[model samples]
Target: MESRRTAVILPGRSYGAYVPQLFFPMLAAQRRGAEVRALDWKRLEELDTIKLDKIARWVSTQVAPVLKDCDPASTVVIGKSLGSYAAPLVARYGLPAIWVTPVLISQDVVDGIKDCAAPRLIVGGSADPVWDADQAFQLSDRVVEIPDADHGLMVDDLARSAAGLGKLATGAEHFLDSIGWTTS
Candidate 1:
């Protein structure tokens, strides 16, 4: 019997898994018949005190348990902002990833994404302070850069932001399909 596919959803510092950015992709994963695991950080306050390079390790500690028995071949990780700190762990597991508005400012995060060999998709907005189009393209061939969206991929106009969100979801679906992960 084949193992079930799994998708782990990691939210940003302020953006919980239920938020539009993370929620829609999660729904897509579920729709594709993957078991979904959304993480809720209980000790967010501890992050402020941690060093930049060490943050990935901290994220790993929190995520390791959830991934204990998961098969890398059938697993994917979807993370946003702070949750992007799990890039190192994702790389270590060689799992395909959907990094939404990843923290490009952190060398650790950037390196993690760079080192990962699995198929990945990176989505970010040009308007976001931490988003670098050049680096995003360098990190992954599959990238979606919104013209004027922010960290949350939101723009000044609400309708435009909503449209951007739809674009992101579509990009994610395409990425998953390209990697041969579909409804089972």
Candidate 2:
């Protein structure tokens, strides 16, 4: 029997999994028959100190049980902004991933992605200070860079933001296809 395909969402601190930017793409993968799981850490917000490694560890702890029996090769992790801390766990599991507006300023995030053997698609905007498009390109040829887009990928023009959403969906679809995660 084929292993079940799973799509896990690791949302940014400010942006939850249901946010349109992260939600729509994960919904697309769900429509393709992948089980969608989201990790929410409310207590993290209340915590005073938020170190990168600690955040990643916390993410891994939240994610471990859900993925305990799942095949890493069949899993896809979608992480955004602060959620990008999970990148190291994704790499350790040897899973493909979709990173949107990741914290490239964190050397750990950059190094984790560099160490990931599975396919990865990094998305960011030139205007997002937290995102390093050059480093993203270096880590993965599969990258989507939106001009004038902010950390949330929202631009001054609503219509442009809508257009960027379309692009984000397309990029996600391409990643799914490349990974051979087909719909029934």
Candidate 3:
């Protein structure tokens, strides 16, 4: 956060209208004095509903251009659970990003991120079913384990990892520092 900018995109989950991860991290990041931006992606939550690839690509187009205009080096993108679909797409523009419980069940998503160069912070609760902590470790050099977090990142049962993002962020920021991005 060299210029104190942190932008996040909160796309909806794949199944329902309102999943549990609505406002916690956004508020947390805003509270931390980081600027945040999000996409209201709930309207398109249906699975197998007409060209989902095109829709995902539409999201990428919507998100990338604004962030690109902002100068990606000044921002950090945060994606949680199914909403994490947009993480690597944004990463292509070269901004560090944080992914919390990313539901990367598809191999295509894995292939999409095969050559990302930005720092990625992965956070997940050990008990999370949809996404696991081990999977997070497999995805990035920076990983954080929350004792009981779930796909719903900060429910009463998931707060351990929610609160743990700060501690994990410290390590991630440290890694960024080691590579020359001194963020506080």
Candidate 4:
């Protein structure tokens, strides 16, 4: 039998830890009996000054308890932008993941995602400067790219952005289901 799973959301520097709509993907995991929680990091504004290694260390410390208690194979990390730096820690444990608008430009982030052995999903936008669509494809075939969307996956038109978010939610559901986390 599969072990009890946990879905940890490591939000971007600007993302809300508890924003219901933005995290519809986590909702699917919750319905599947996964314990879901969002990590609230301190000193986010200072993230710009800190090196990637330091940020990674801080994130690792914050997520230590979850990794310690849960089955690593069943731990699913959902990280975005700045939070993507934590992907390596999850990879080290061989956990599945969903990276939203990841910092594709960062070699460390790309390498971490590349090293992850479990199921993974990458979501980004073509217009996002930091999003490397090709690199994302190379890392994981499970990818969602929003046309014309910017770094935050927001396009010029609000309707387009909403549509993109809806797509992302659908993709998230599919990814979770593929990993055997679905109620179905």
Give the winner by TM-score: 1
- Cα lDDT of model 4 overall? 0.82
Clashing pairs in 1: none
Best by lDDT: 1
Each model's lDDT: 0.89, 0.83, 0.57, 0.82
Candidate 3, residues 95-140: lDDT per residue as tens digits? Answer: 6666666666644345444446777766666667756555566778
Angstrom error of the Cα, residue 29, model 3: value is: 4.6
lDDT of 2 by residue, 1-184 (tens): 7777788888888757988779867987897888888888668764457665576677667766765665876788888887787777778778889998899998878888989999999999889998887898999989999889999889999999988888888898888888887666
lDDT of 1 at 143: 96
Q: Looking at model 3, report the run of 10 residues with the lowest lDDT sum.
A: 15-24
lDDT of 1 by residue, 1-184 (tens): 7888888998898857889998888888888889888998878899899987788888888987877777887888999998888888888888889999999998988998999999899999999999999999999989999999999999999999999999999998888888887656
TM-score, candidate number 3: 0.67
Query: What global local distance difference test value does model 2 have?
Result: 0.83
- lDDT at 120, model 4: 94
TM-scores for all predictions: 0.96, 0.92, 0.67, 0.90
Candidate 1 positional error at 81, Å? 0.6
Ranking by TM-score: 1, 2, 4, 3
